[model samples]
Target: MMHSLAVRVYYEDTDLAGIVYYANYLKFIERGRSEWLRDLGIDQAAMKENSGHVFAVRRIEADYLRPARFDDLLSVETALVQATAARIVLDQTVRRDDAALFAARVTLACLDGSGRPVRLPKGLAEALAAG
Candidate 1:
């Protein structure tokens, strides 16, 4: 199943040409991922404090299909594509209604405080799978 979040383009999200800056698409999907985890009862800060684990974006493959302009209302659709002991992969898209404007495959790695790879919390894996 896919999870979604709504985003309204702010002027700051745009360039002088009125289209959203290329980098901001990453921001939009990042929010989608964070909210998805939040809704699944994951508190990132608490996870870090309790488990000494943090999630880092290890890789991203993105395609910008079209431009989103200032004031455009968009939805970011996200779904888990895969999960491993130390990594999670997500498929995400930014859309206007049914039109896809951007798409990405993001890989997140679980890391210890010392920045070494670590297993994701068990509860996190279960929750993400269920969600």
Candidate 2:
């Protein structure tokens, strides 16, 4: 399943050139992933509180293709690429209209409160698989 979130580039999101700063694309995609999990009925806060488990980015391979200027309406699209006991892989893209501005493959690891790797919650794993 694919999930998309809308983002508007504000002045703060841009650099002196009035174009979105490269790092902000990561923020956009992060929101996309969070919303995607929410849509799948995964409550991150509850999971962390109840199970002491949280997700952290383990790796990211990103490509910046085009520039997004201030005030541009952008869409961040996220899709699950794979899910495992301890990790999930996602493909995400930032687009303006139909044009892809940035793309990334992100790997996220489930971690315990102690910051040690842990298996994903059963419900979350199942939800991701079903989706």
Candidate 3:
């Protein structure tokens, strides 16, 4: 399943040139992923408190395709590409209307409080698999 989130580019998200800062694209995609998980009924805070595990970015490959200006309404789309016991791969894209402004492949690892790799919690794994 693909999930989409709407974001409005703010002045603070841009550079002096009024174009979105390159790194803010990452933030937009992160929000997309967070909302995606939320929609799947995975609560990160409760997962952390009950299981002592959290999801952390393990890798990200991103491309800045075009410029987004302040106040532009953008849509960030996220989809799960693959999932494993302790890792998941997702594809995300940011678009201004129908034009793609950015794209990324992100990997996340499940980690214990000690920062050691751990299997995803049972419910999260089930949710991802079902989705």
Candidate 4:
């Protein structure tokens, strides 16, 4: 796995009926992937300062399977499904304990200042692999 992050749904994270808002799950998954990269010494700001590169979500196809509720402790699991010179595929899942609530397959790209594609930094691709 790339990395996993635990998140708790607060009242602010939920709808009036106590169900988590759909958009919040996307926020959780995004944080999971960011933390995964941080674990590998990849800081978006530092990457730009040092190498003039940054990573961006080029496309995403996500599914919301079940509704999460307030106070539910969920885990966001991230894994690298594939990689190329300029792009990567990340598989992410959100689970409440043992129950899966949502999932996504995100296609991301590395880009320079102009937003054009650029090759991933050396070792970045290797680090994205599951252990």
Model 1 residue runs over 4 Å out of place are: none
Could you list the CA RMSD of all candidates, in the order they appear? 0.9, 0.5, 0.6, 1.6
**Positional deviation of 75 in candidate 3, in angstroms?**
0.3
Winner on lDDT between 1 and 2 is: 2
Q: Encode model 4's per-residue lDDT on 1-131: one tens digit a residue.
A: 55889999899999988899988888999999889888877787788998888888889898999999988889999988888999989899999988889999999899988988999987686665534
Question: Total backbone clashes of model 4?
Answer: 0
* lDDT computed for candidate 3: 0.95
Residues 1-131, model 3: lDDT tens digits: 89999999999999999999999998899899999999999999999999899989999999889999999999999999999999999999999999999999999999999999999999999998787
TM-score, one value per model: 0.97, 0.98, 0.98, 0.92
Model 4 stretches with alpha carbons more than 4 Å out: 129-131
Residues 30-101, model 2: lDDT tens digits? 999999999999999999999999999999999999999999999999999999999999999999999999
lDDT of 1 at 96: 93
Q: State the lDDT at 1 in candidate 2.
A: 95
64-104: candidate 1 lDDT, tens digit per residue: 99999989999999999999999999999999989999999
Better of 1 and 4 by lDDT: 1
Report residue 106 deviation for candidate 4 (angstroms).
Answer: 0.5
